[model samples]
Target: MSEYIKVAVDAMGGDYAPQEPVKGVVEALREKPELYVYLVGQEDVLKKELDKYTYPEERLEVVHASEIIETGEPPVHAIQKKKDSSLVKALRMVRSKEASAFVSCGSTGAVLVGGQVLVGKSKGVERAPLAPLIPTATGVSLLIDCGANVDARSSHLVQFARMGSIYMEYVMGVKNPKVGLVNIGAEEEKGNALVKETYPLLKECKDINFIGNVEARDIPKGVCDVVVCEAFVGNVILKLYEGVGATLISKVKAGMMSTLRSKIGALLVKPALKETLKSFDASEYGGAPLLGLKGLVVKAHGSSKANEIKNSLIQCITFSKEDICGKIQENMKQDNKGDN
Candidate 1:
């Protein structure tokens, strides 16, 4: 018998809703026959979407949910009001240990709230932070605290670094991933109170690689494999990195079409550029994992399509198969022991 990983997916979450997320779950089953998914959402709509895809009947199951959480509402309020919602139902599965992991492309606040309130946090986890991945010239780097907990403390940044290092070393296959604290300058004296304080603390910590500060300009250059910061700085770096990348690509395409000569030049460079830029497509990477929670809760991009959802579901398989949770527990143990 093939081993199966039970993953509960919130079908009604995200801007794409039923069609895209459903399509993603189906695609994952197709790729990995051993993945058993229990989709939580309105039965009628989820079934309607599933009828379109040709998947193994035994592999897919539906766990009915009647409500959906919106992006605007307070997370705690939404969780309380919408008990029957897909997001809540999925978290319940994690709490009950019915599913190995949970994946959601829903409200960022709601996911964070659900993670802490329902799924709970690890033994020493101060707060559960959203860690989305970004591809660098060296490879992919884990950008910790991308979404939740905006007002974070220096100790939180240190924990993010510790947890991030463990994740990159095990899941990402990065050898000695250099950890860098996001800052205004590489100098130790530069930055606001948070970065300035974090710099020395990180430097003193012997557990992480602790390569000092990484400026915003060096992000695309892939100077560091692990970028650690509080949610405020981390979120800004993520959004700005994406914005600059998108704007540059848009300008390039426009410039290429502006003249006949440029248009002819485009054909020769299109393939190379596509290959080079392929890693930059954030959608291809799927969702960000909300680490430090007892159970894994992923927040897929709001603009996630079927393929992105598919990747997120695929990620769950790896999440369980590789025993990421157990490894994290061990890392936390070592982190608490000492700097090294």
Candidate 2:
């Protein structure tokens, strides 16, 4: 392929716009000499931002795009209409095999829609899932279908489990990662029709380590490496996880500053507490990937800053190096052979 793991970044995407995305690219270039980033956006704006940072000029190139895809626009229409937009231009690079992956903090809907239309799906993948790693008590777990495929089928959930397993195993360095279907109870018949059907399918698959049902309550306790569900359920769990983590962190800080005794205590434990809390930060894990596509397409937070963007770009290195898309396709081929 390319000499470097070229990442076509949507410089105009995200709440922070050209500034944060530009800074993140410069920051990423400083960290990795192997990474070649094509910052796709308005040339003049990107150039101005680049001037503020000192990084290797050769590694960071800019592709001029005339337009920007606003978050509020309808995804399908935007992708079709905004051909010269930053988001579409960056995706086209991936489609053309000029870039290894595409990273965007822009419209999630646009990314999801364009990724499938532009990058296309693997041979046997029916539906792509948005898989994001969420922090847990012990570590982090992959929450598949977080925002894509809300009405996913049993077979789709089964594939999600398998993809999630591969991602956890190879990229995250977890071996035979445990896969759990999100359910109300541990019983086989606890969930709706889809989960019940998928439960048996997952159990029959010898490829993944199928770890029965995982209750929502136990999710934060590091219940499993991969949690599988329809997009609706998965999204709820993810939102709740984010909300609770944020609330708890706020409450903890407020409590520490409430009174003289706690204030004194906060100072003594500040270093250790900060270290612990930082581990749970979602940004530390990078962006959520839309798996099952032919090429890697990651969707960073809409409000992403430099660190998040940098991490998202950095995350693609592992995906490309490990050949995650290839592995998923191979696994599906092997599974299909067994079925036949």
Question: Looking at candidate 1, what is the lDDT of residue 120?
Answer: 91
Query: 1-340, model 2: which lDDT tens digit per residue?
Result: 2558899999999899989989888999999888999999999999998999899998988999999999989999999998999999999999898998999999999999999999999999989999999999999999999875588888898889999999999999999999999999999988888888888888888888999999999988998999999999989988888898899989999999999999999999999999998888888888999999889999999988899999998889889999999999998777645442
The local lDDT score (0 to 100) that residue 158 gets in candidate 2 is 85
TM-score of 1: 0.94
Clashing residue pairs found in predicted model 1: 207-339
Total clashes in model 2, counting residue pairs 3 or more apart in sequence or in different chains:
0
TM-scores of the candidates in the order shown: 0.94, 0.96
RMSD of each: 1.9, 1.6
Model 2 ranges off by over 4 Å = 336-340
Clashes of each: 1, 0
- Mind giving the per-residue lDDT tens digits that candidate 1 earns over 100-186? 788888898999889889999888787777899987776678999786678888888888988888777776777888999888788
